[model samples]
Target: MSHRIVSKFGYYSLAGFAGSALVQLAVIWPQTWIAVVALGAIALLYFAFLLICIKGVLKGARWAGVLNFNVLGVDAIESTGIVLFFVVGGVWTCLQIL
Candidate 1:
């Protein structure tokens, strides 16, 4: 689990967000100018976590581990919300048919 907890998923999460921020900006061009700040903030958070882990400047290695898990925790929360929405929507449609 250390591979996932410490290295694999956390690093990928940061990189993925950074990539998405760029894509998000491109997709939201013109009228939605403010999305740059919003998505940039999310992307920066991931990069900051990556920097702290790589730099070894934190008080302890444990804090990096904690932050890594926190990243996963956030991912799970967002995924759960989306999943719950779909589940609720599906049930609502089913109920209407019944």
Candidate 2:
């Protein structure tokens, strides 16, 4: 196993976080201050994880790999849940509006 793979994931996570923030801030435009603040906090947390991943990978630490997989698992679950909501529940999906 190579740390390169973890670094790659970190990069992808960074992109994803940036894209998600763009969508929330620009495209969706959250309706309330609370929502905006919450989103910002989440974005910060994601970036923190990315930094931790980079540090761990660079140091060849086992904890970094573990953290990476744990974060990946959580993301997979959230994505799968959203997709299932649309596909299985016949939900009408729409972007958030300000």
Candidate 3:
């Protein structure tokens, strides 16, 4: 695959993960100030890292591609796990609320 495509995917994945984390925070703890701040911080850091990765990819750095690929793979796995955990937790919460 072209570096551009890889870079786009990496950027999108990071954004998606940040969005999901924010959503999860809202769902699991709607009124917690600390959760809000922490999730916002995490999202910011992820965006910064994604920008750096994209720049490196555009610059034709071999190590950047390797690092980006590994980070993307790990992010994919982590997101999948987070989604599953939330799905199960949501069901449990609904049952309790009912």
For this target, which candidate reaches the highest TM-score against the unseen true structure? 3
lDDT of 3 by residue, 1-98 (tens): 79987785565556555545555656668775466456556655665776677688778787796872644566655654444444444445444543
Cα lDDT of candidate 1 equals 0.49
**CA lDDT of 80 in candidate 1?**
39
* Residue-level error in angstroms, candidate 1, position 56: 3.6
In model 2, what lDDT does residue 39 have? 53
User: Which segments of model 2 are wrong by more than 4 Å?
Assistant: 1-31, 67-98
After superposition, candidate 1 runs with Cα above 4 Å error = 1-29, 57-62, 65-98
**Model 1, residue 52: displacement in angstroms?**
0.7
Model 2 weakest 10-residue run by lDDT: 85-94
Q: Which stretches of candidate 3 lie over 4 Å from their true place?
A: 1-31, 68-98
Q: Which scores better on TM-score, 2 or 3?
A: 3
TM-score for all models, in order of appearance: 0.31, 0.38, 0.40
Count clashes in each candidate, considering only residues at least 3 apart in sequence or on different chains: 0, 0, 0
Instruction: Quantify how close model 2 is to the true structure by its C-alpha RMSD in Å.
Output: 12.1
In terms of TM-score, how similar is model 3 to the real structure? 0.40
Instruction: By lDDT, rank the candidates, best first.
Output: 3, 2, 1
lDDT of each: 0.49, 0.51, 0.58
